[model samples]
Target: MKDRRRFSRVPFKTEVEVLFERRRLAAKNLKDISLKGLYVVAPERPPVGEICQVKVKLTGAEPPVELIFTGEVVRHGPDGFAIVVTETDLESFAHLRKLLSYNLADPEKIEAELGRLIR
Candidate 1:
């Protein structure tokens, strides 16, 4: 099958907290991330198209920046679910960009990927 993803995803294992309802939160492992989305490894799968808030703490950073974003459940499977980020704060986007740059071997590749997505 052809890959339909808009951005290239890199393996990123980290803690993620998903809030789908009021006073309810689920802690899961972030399996991977791209500029547009991320995959959360959790047993409880939310229905597709559901909008939720996700918070990811970047532990590799010095102060461990926490990124908060709104995302929609795009795909689901036995292991976990994939969320397409719909909104993010400026600081959160900056942190995510930094994290991706640190994890990827070639930063230019990400630039190219983003370029492709924009076009």
Candidate 2:
């Protein structure tokens, strides 16, 4: 089967905190992440198109990295919901880059995958 994903996603497991209406926060497990978005495993799925703030604390790094961003719920199913990231800072981008670099081998493959995302 052909993979239709734009950006290459690496399998990542981490705890993610999502804030929805009324500043209520829910903790969920993050399944995977790409440059564009992430997948969160949640029993109570949020409505599609709903926007929420997400905080992901990535450990195992030298000093750890915290990624805080706003995203929209693009898909929801039995497994979990997918979030399309809307906003992020430079620090988050750097951390994501580092994570991908560590997880993904072959620089040529990474270049090709990222090139597909641009086009």
Candidate 3:
């Protein structure tokens, strides 16, 4: 199948908490995150199209930071589920950029993508 992703994915692995249907699920992640969304592997998967909250714990920040996104479940498969990000707070957005910038080969490319994202 053709990849429809607009943003480049960064290989990131960490513990992520998925909140859906008023229940919080702990996921041991094999995560690949982008500016747009993330892939999460959890035992209990949220249904497609379900609106949920995802909190990705950034393990090594000075104090600590959780990159939180309010997103929709867009796909489900054996690997787990894919969430398409709808919204995030300003701090989370900033941290997300930093994380992606650190991981991706061309930091400026992501910044360029961010500019395109606005329109």
Question: What residue pairs are clashing in model 2?
Answer: none
* C-alpha lDDT of residue 91 in model 2: 85
Residue-wise C-alpha lDDT for candidate 3, range 1-119, written one tens digit per residue: 99966799999999899999999988989479999999998767899999999999988977878999999999997879999999999999999999999999999989988987888
Highest lDDT scorer? 3
lDDT of 2 by residue, 15-36 (tens): 8888877565565578888888
Worst 10 residues of 1 by lDDT: 20-29
lDDT of 1 by residue, 1-119 (tens): 99877677889888898888563456558899998999999988778998999999878768888999999999997789999999999899878877788788898777887677568
Error of 2 at 21 (Å): 1.3
TM-score of 3: 0.94
**Sort order, TM-score high to low:** 3, 1, 2
- Candidate 2, run of 10 with poorest lDDT: 105-114
lDDT of every model, 2 decimals:
0.85, 0.82, 0.91
List the candidates' TM-scores in order: 0.89, 0.84, 0.94
What is candidate 3's local distance difference test score? Answer: 0.91
Error of 3 at 32 (Å): 0.6
Candidate 1: lDDT over CA atoms?
Answer: 0.85
Q: What are the per-model numbers of colliding residue pairs?
A: 0, 0, 0
